[model samples]
Target: MSDLDLGVIGNCAVAALVDRDARVVWYCLPRFDGDPVFHALLGAPKDAPDDGVFAIELEDHVHSEQHYIENTAVLVTELHGRQGSLRITDFAPRFVWRDRLFYPQALVRRLTPISGSPRIKIRLRPRFEYGSVAPARTYGSHHIRYVGPQTTMRLTTDATIDFIRDETFFNLSAPLDLFLGPDETLQLGVKETADRLEERTLVYWRTWTHRLATPFEWQDAVIRAAITLKLCTYEPTGAIVAALTTSIPESPGTQRNWDYRFCWLRDAYFVVRALNRLAAVRKMENYFRWLMNIVASLHENDIQPVYGIGLENKLIEREIPDLPGYRGMGPVRVGNQAYEHLQYDNYGNVILGVAQMFLDRRLLSPPNRADFQHLEALGRRALKFYDQPDAGMWEYRTRASVHTTSSLMCWAAADRLARIALHIGETQRASEWRASADRIREVILERSWSKKRQAFVDSFEGEYLDAGVLLMTEVDFIDPRDPRMVSTVKQLEKVLGRGPHMMRYEAADDFGAPGTAFNTCSFWRIDALARMGRVEEAREYFSELLKLRNRLGMMSEDVDTKSGEMWGNYPQTYSLVGIVNCAVRLSRPWEAII
Candidate 1:
């Protein structure tokens, strides 16, 4: 496998690539949500003729293998070469102190050559604000300052190294140190030393991972998925972003690119469920608290389907005229404008996540209780728009249709509200919500189902089947054995199922062109199959889907089966959650399928 080709774009939130030699060749400092500090992944360098964008040459041609550390947000990459072997573990630790709360930093890169001497090349080049600004460097004994507007990166090294202004490089034959300081200055002796830093980082990670309540059989996958989900979270706001990077085309250069750095209300239920399963009560509680704050911030008449890191409802979608997209996909976009569109499913997700918390009797923080009340009021307000025509979950481009998925979400919201009210002893209000849920359920069965097709349609009026309907089984909208459920699964297999995997739907009918199959939907199909008592088929498909993960056991948003190349964003949280959920389900007894 000498011809092994391995490259990754942290297009989602954290766009960085670690080579086979265990070097992070490209990385955008600060945060994944921040602009690229390394633009090599998007395009070639122009300003620095001799110095390339960012490159790291390993000490030896080591055989490298990589994977995320189980149940924590750390990445471990091991390299074994003719000379010797070494392991490099990388992670951006969660901020613990209030003073360091907003610090967007990553640490802990230990390079210990086990046996033979190996030479390593070190290079540091940072392009600030998505390559829009290049900072001036000032070299010091232990650090180099790259200063830009409102952003400064102090690169510190432990060993005496040559400062390369334009393509300056050096060979390391002994132990060395490298530190990345973001928006902060470094005082060689004042700043934490390499040995102390490594010890603290390891302890931080070990302490956090020790908190997890491991489940039977599938602990490794669950822990990794949970950690990935946590890494995607914006700690300050308690908002979990959909993904880290954006504009990684579903196809090589197609226009299907989108930014996924912002939090989506639709992901609320899934995130809470995943965290709750792992016994991370604090994480789940923080999410609800955040949602409450968002709800309170909304006006009686203003409700957005998504929100920014600060819970701001406004997000203007626009293309960057300068920066070329990942792999040359044009029109790189920032800030999603889908907030204005009506995605009715969000109401359901919010209610479900909050209700889960309520069920646990987790008292809302005193300051956030008012926000929960506001959320309840907003639920009432959403009822007015529930029956209105708007964009569906897929965020389709055409005119609004009564999306089956949206209607299902409406049912979920009402059902959750009814349960919450009942749990809190609000008998009268609970009855009203229950009645509303029943009506929505009736409409879904009556209008969304196609008798001729014997399956649920994507919309109340359309004839197409949607993969999202798979969630019906997940939310208890219908029993897995229900005739309607079986029929919908079969219909989805016919229209959306591609071999062992499932597509979001017929691409030609919805997006006007065919594209890579969505990886998460395929896992959902596996979950649905397992729920329907097709254990043998589910296990077979599950095994096959697991094979699709990249060499590092990481998955992107989509996959091109023919060439077997991952498409869309790398390290997709949704895809990882799907893996965790399915793995846990498959590991359980038949009676415990739920």
Candidate 2:
């Protein structure tokens, strides 16, 4: 069974997950959401034989250790054996080539001897159509091409091909470079090419991370989270996926699996916002271009909660029955059905995503009056649905309700629009928006708050508590220290807190109650506690939460709070964003340390 104990390597366009033993377990071809080429993470059960993995097994190996190169996507894994130890270096080549950024759909693995002579066997299996068909392969002296119906990849290696082809153990004496990418022959020596790419990629990542305005504390944690979030971005179209793999069950033995490769409007908003906090402005600008496309594609003012990275609209949901899911949980899914559902909070999220365009003068393109007009149209849509029922931010598939978070976001939409209008000299429009925002706020306070509970409820006049209600303080919908906000934080912590983590909500949904704690919600709780002036307490929980990350400092969507194991999707953008937000919020300024 596959687990979240994986390190991520990518160049923003394509990402692959490698397990602790250095098996390239989950890798999608062509793009982030494409066919799974390295599908060992969801391989067929032991009863049925399948080939969808790339692994290097060292004979007599006893233990292994893995970590990412500091502040970079490059991963290093060490395999210890009785005879010797070997080091495997993995990364996707991404650096400035010519004048354009050259981030190909490729992963390069470099293996070298660390100590004595160790024998190793290489297994390269590339599958297609979600692991239903194994690709036919044709080999050259230096490379092997795995040809599938939809895609083909060539693995160029410096190692002897016979050993790889026959899966025979070979004595390791020197380093070998394996480049798996587009079906093309290598122009340069595979060793030289791999080394150059590694050098340049390392330089590229370190250069990128060097520019970040990180906080004084938790610098390493913040950098790792930022890099993880950056890896989730689909650069060609500026769409940030929620997570890399799909149908990783939120909790063991639960069918709450759903595809998360698409660009969730809400998730992308938080992703860009978090990156922006680190002064990684390019991601937000690239994302703004993507968001503008969605805004332009509006028909009848229809808004979707998610879209494909290339802005493809119809995300028809279905299952890939051929491959078992994470931990043999079946029904591995593709295409999220949320695109067809109305998650009303997206209107607010969309506006919030681009609102920075108007305020930040450093961007290549600043918002003009014309842009304000486009945003005003979006504001109209928000007011129209502020009180209407729809699938809230959680995308609760079974029911639609007037969720409090939806209202808070709609209120945020009006409030931000009012602020933008004032900045752009549209005083009349500003006043109108301010009035609209005030009205929405009044309604939320009246309907969402429960006198008996002394805290806000999930939906209007509802009796249940929800961690999402904590968003009220996040968007400035409510003062952080307001009595109601304080009570809401305390109430949510009492109901949803799971040790150091927090569940998304207390109420059960379509799949029944959530078994694992939502990682993002836990981070939000830290922010809320800090905002309420409980810095020491919040810091304690934050430190404990950070410990939940895997060995490589990577987090998933949810956590098995009972066992302190990670669950749900790996490298979740929402959970990562919480790291940035909380770190930035709680970190003392650099001047203080200085």
Candidate 3:
């Protein structure tokens, strides 16, 4: 049985998920939101013939191992057979070329013989409409064009055309380069183009990693996590996807699957905060631009929690019936209905994302008075909805409550705006925002705390606990050492904690009780513990949580704490954010080593 030990390769334009066996299992072409071109991860049973998978498998396969080149997004998988072994190098070409960045929405696989004579088989099955339609193929001298109903792709390769087309076995004698990209003939031959791309992409990733101001501890883990996060960014639009592939269930058959391919304003705060801490400005700057566009496009009371990467407003949910889901589960979903739901927490997030522009002098073009006026409009919305019932951060489908987390963030928006106003020398506006923040603070303290429970609950006048409340100290809604915060952590640990992993909440959700621990919640636990002066305990728990990452140092959205298997969407941005933030918070100061 395979674990969720998968490797991801992308060029900030597109991404793919490859298993240990070197199969391109899950990929969306042209862009992250485009229809699936390779959709094997949401499968039609492993033994079924022509299951719409893309694999370069060895006929004499024995075993295989997968890993990344150090500090890079490039992935290498070594497959050993009874007779011979082969190495596959997988990446999407992304680098600076001719004074411009060249990042094509393409996947390149280079197969080389390691030892002995290796017999290999090539299977390229590109699907359309979320694996509901198989593409018709037309072949030429050195290329194969796969034409689907809505999309077309071309495969340019150096391998024998007959062998690839027929899926026949061939003995490997030399290198074979396969470039699967948008429907265009390769100007240069496959081998030469692939060689140049491999060299440049390697340099691009290394140079990009070289600029990171990593912590003194866990440098490798941080770098890998940072790269994964970068790959999730859709550079053309500057929107970072929550994850790559979608509907990989939170756990087996729980129906907790969600499409995370779009951009969520709520996630932007944490994503930009993590990148900003590392002094990586490019992602932040790009994301700010994306946000500004969304802000500029917003009408009164029309802001949404989520948007298409292109800022499209509608996302209607539907299932791909032809594709049996990940791990043989059914109902693989396409669009996410959460876009239509009310998630008031987004208003605060929008303000927080822009607040950095006003405060950070490093920004090339910081926010002006006009920018603050737009942001204050969002702040006004947060002020209106902060006390109302709506969907909380978890995006519960069937429930509504005056969620303390949402209210706290409303406070954060007003509080941060006050400081931002001060930075821009607007004393009167600063005072007004400060008054609004204080009013929110008073409301939270009066209504959200449970005198009987001796802790801050998940909602006003409710008795349940949520892992999100652990974020109280994080957003500065409450001091780390405050009695209420400390008590909330204690009570939360007893109720929501499952061993070291923390569930988002124990309350029954749309899918009933959660079957897996949301990985980022545990990271919040680690951060809270660290700030509470429980240094040794925090270090131990943090180390234990790091052990749960997949072999590639990547994490999904959740993990089955009992079986220690990762689930949810692959290479989750929130999970990686937790790693970078925790490492930065817990690592020893540079002065200790210097």
Candidate 4:
């Protein structure tokens, strides 16, 4: 059975998920949205034995352990067998070279002997078109070429070619180097280039890590979460993906699987906000450019919830019929259909993402009048549909209601725009935006509240509770101490809360009732509890949630509270942000130490 314990390595240009046994279970080519050349992560038991894996196995393998190299994205896995122990250092080359950041579409794996003589087997399986087809291969003196339908990758190695081709055991007396990358020949000896790349990559990561302003406590956990979030970013266009690989079901046998490779505007505010807290604004600065480009392409009242990394629209969600999903869950999906859903919260998200540029002087360059003009356009749409019905943040298909969360986001959009306008010294515009926000808030307060239930509900005149309403205080739509908020939190606890874990909502959706707890929502509950002066209780609950993370200190989108198994996509940006936010909020002030 799969434990979902995986280590990720990437150069921001490309990334791979290495399981505990050091197999490259998941890696896309060219870019995060590109096809999967190694699709073992989604392979089913019915598929060919080596249908979708790239692994280096020690003969008679017994056990293994994996961890990142301190603060870097590099992963080191140790495999022990009856014969001896082997160490594999894996990383996608990322570092400063030639006075600029160089992130190549290459994965470098170096294997070394750690003990008595150990024999190993090299298994290379590359699939194409979402694992629906296998690629043909041809070998050379020192490399092998995998010819796929749309791409070709060369595997250059320093190990014996015959052993690799024959899949036979080979004695490990010295280190072996393998580089899987573009079809280009190496200029230097394998060991020399690998050594320089490894050293430079280490320096680059350490330098990057040194700049982070993490909390005094939980520094290691925060650093790992930050690095994982950074890896999910596609550098070319500055779009941060929600997660690396997609289609990992939220729970077993559930159709809740969706691709998260594309950038969601809903994620922009949180992503930038979390990074800004780290005092690392480079990613936010770069992402602002991507957001601006998306803004430029938007017509009046036409903002989307998601877009391609390069701002390419029309991500048609479809199923790959051939390949079975992770752990034999069917309907492997490519692209995302959420693009077509009318997620009105997107308007507010866009404004929030860019509003900071107007106020934060720490950025290298701040937004100008033209940027404000573009933001005003989004604000206009938010004002237009604050009370209108569409898919909520959960992307609920076959459902359309005047979702209070969506409407509250509209209020947030107006509120932030008012602040931005005031900052730019446009008093008239600021007052107008403030009035708009006030109107939306009034409507939300009047209608979203349920007199019968003695709490605010999911929508107008509704009785069912929604976990998303928990964000009202966090987003500043309502005060934490407000009687309605207090009552609502109590109502949410009674209905949606499962011990410390909380479900996004208890209502049945496209799928049946959600069995897995949405991890980020639980964190939101912690935040809510702390803000409500329940610090001791919040701390207790937060500690329990921390234990749910895998051995690698990473989390996915959802978890089965009953079994404590992480499900959904790995290295989830939302879940990682929870760690950073909770740590920052819960950590004692520096003055306490001083």
- Model 3 stretches with alpha carbons more than 4 Å out: 1-3, 45-49
Give candidate 2's error at residue 401 in angstroms.
1.3
Query: Each model's TM-score?
Result: 0.89, 0.98, 0.98, 0.98
Global CA lDDT of candidate 4, please? Answer: 0.88
**Model 2 lDDT, residue 187, Cα:** 87
* lDDT (Cα, tens digit) per residue for candidate 3, span 328-419: 76678888999988888888888877677777778786668888898888899889999999889989889899999899988998999999
1-594 per-residue lDDT for model 1 (tens digits):
111123332211243555555545446555555666655545534454222244444555646777655444455666666666556655543434555532345443545555565545556666666666678777876667888776777766665546344434344455554556564555444235556554454565567668876556566656666666766666666787777666777777578877887778886568778777667767677777678887766666555677876687778888865566666676678788788888777778787776766667544543234444555676675565566677888777666877888878878888887887787777888898899888888888888889887898888867877899899998889999899899899989987888877788764544465567888899889999999999889888878877776665667788876766777765677788787788778875445554
Model 4: pairs clashing at backbone N, Cα or C within 3 Å: none
RMSD of each: 3.8, 1.2, 1.4, 1.2
Top lDDT hit: 2
Q: Of models 1 and 3, which has the larger TM-score? A: 3
Segments of candidate 4 deviating more than 4 angstroms: 44-47
Model 4 lDDT per residue over 254-327, tens place: 87788999999987678888988898888888898999999888876488899999898999988887668888
lDDT of each: 0.67, 0.89, 0.87, 0.88
Worst 10 residues of 4 by lDDT: 43-52
TM-score of 1: 0.89
lDDT (tens digit, per residue) of candidate 2 on 1-594: 678889999999899999999999999989999998888887663434557788999999999999989989999999999988999999998899899999999999999999999899999978888877778889899999999998989999989998898999999999998999998877899999998999999999999999999999999999999999999999898889999989988888798788889899889888888998999999888998888888877856578899999899999999887887777887788998899998888889999988888889889866678777877888899999999999898889889999999988999999999999898888999999999999999999999999988899999999899999877777878788999989888888788887778888878899888889999889888988888899998999999998988888889898888788888888899998998999999998998878
Of candidates 2 and 1, the better by TM-score: 2
